[model samples]
Target: MELLRNARDAGARNIYVASVLRRRRYRTLTVLDDGQGVDERYATLIFEPGVTTRHLNPTIEAVDPNSPPHGAGLSLYHIRNLAVRSSLLSAASPTSITVTFDTRVLPERSLQSTTRPSRSNLRATVENFARTSRTSAFYYAQPAKILASLIKNHIIHNDESAVELVELAEALGLRISTRTAQKIKNGEIPAIERIDGSGDGGRRRVMTERGGEVDGSTALLDLGDEQMSRIAVILREAAHASYVEVHDLRQSSRPGEITLTARVREPEDEYE
Candidate 1:
């Protein structure tokens, strides 16, 4: 039902649904569409709470004031919350959303045997599985979106060290390596990059560079300035009491000159 809503929201006139048992205990549910597909930038974020592209346009609120709040972007989020594993594959030519559900709790023989159960019994089992899958919700809820942008801005403007950024990330509950921080600083880890689909509307591909090897797809993180600032302040306060984002250290440095500043708030009032 939620997938249908997303397909309609994407302006897909004809959506195809396919289900198959890939392994003994795994089932894949794929939804194919021909519409304005999601960009690679928001591929992963579409499942995060309160993220949406549908809200960009003027919705039908003016036509019907009594309408419920639309474009919460919660459909995919909830779908992901329900599924054991989920994925979104989008292309300019053809868009698709695929989700996998684990049916391992029930033996494969029970569902796929020659002596199949009644339609009502099978439906009940499927519904029960859906209900119970919520126990395995995704839990990586650190403010990574904010932390990524904060690190990017600090690297560009404040000349913050990778070590410092990693420290701050860890302080704020995000665990990233020094190499990842360097990649982000060097623009190798872009916030977003376009994927080139094949001429025959084949699979979507994203190119990435790591250890001199061009790798497969990478998703982008979309973090707004306001969100970054708010989360930064919160994280800073939590990590170090009373210290804030002061720019006095950069006043005397030449443009692009790297310098590290260690600021401590003195109880006595004194200006640096």
Candidate 2:
């Protein structure tokens, strides 16, 4: 959510948060930023792991991995491929970063709604999705990079197991099905895990350690190639039947297409 906050901080003139591409109901979103560019020579320099220009500023000098520098320096430059944008090449004075994400690939987003949901009110709908934390820095700036990184990097504060896959997906503003839920469980998609350890020993586990993780047997796509191809085939058949199916498919799938799982520590959870 800090990414949302930072977006707001940059006083970003244009905020275009929308679905860029879609897969078998999955979406990959692209967030472009026109904030002041990095040093042309240092365009690629910012993304190197453990690299940050924030240290130059005394206020942000005490840089803990947790206490990230300005959101700019701390986002996922490490996995530029995941973002699939040229950090160096794209980051001219007006820089842009596009993040491609896997939907249903995470638990759900957390809910911290201050107000109750109202069906009669259109304002409620907008407000529900509206950015709540007004001052978190990236609120106005594009959050794709930071948010994708946050979920990918497991940098947020929370207990992974305490949160369910569907719940984490909600936190990220997406959804899934029982089959999808089972995949998250089966795949153990790194960021969040189920609190499934035996006896009382398990209850004491930290949130980060409790959630499931991706393993060798897990298919890269939660739905697997067969299901995805099957869905694609079904869609193709529907499309052959009617052009309306194309619109229906897109409209029904957009929100969930762009999903991100909660970020988890690699190889080990801090809780353990």
What's the lDDT for all of these models?
0.47, 0.36
Give the C-alpha lDDT of model 1. 0.47
Clash pairs, candidate 1, are none
- Please give the range of 10 consecutive residues that has the lowest summed lDDT in model 1: 134-143
> Residue-wise lDDT of candidate 2 within 62-152, one digit each (tens)?
2244564555555556344344332333443223444444435522233333222222222222223243322221211112323333343
Best by lDDT: 1
Q: Would you estimate the TM-scores of all the predictions?
A: 0.36, 0.33
Candidate 2 residue spans exceeding 4 A from truth = 1-13, 57-74, 78-89, 107-272
Clashing residue pair totals per candidate (backbone < 3 A)? 0, 41
| Model 1 lDDT, residue 221, Cα | 39
**Alpha carbon deviation, residue 86, candidate 1 (Å):** 1.1
Model 1, 69-167: lDDT tens digits are 565888788778767777775443345676766766433334432222321233223233223232211111112332344343332132568887677
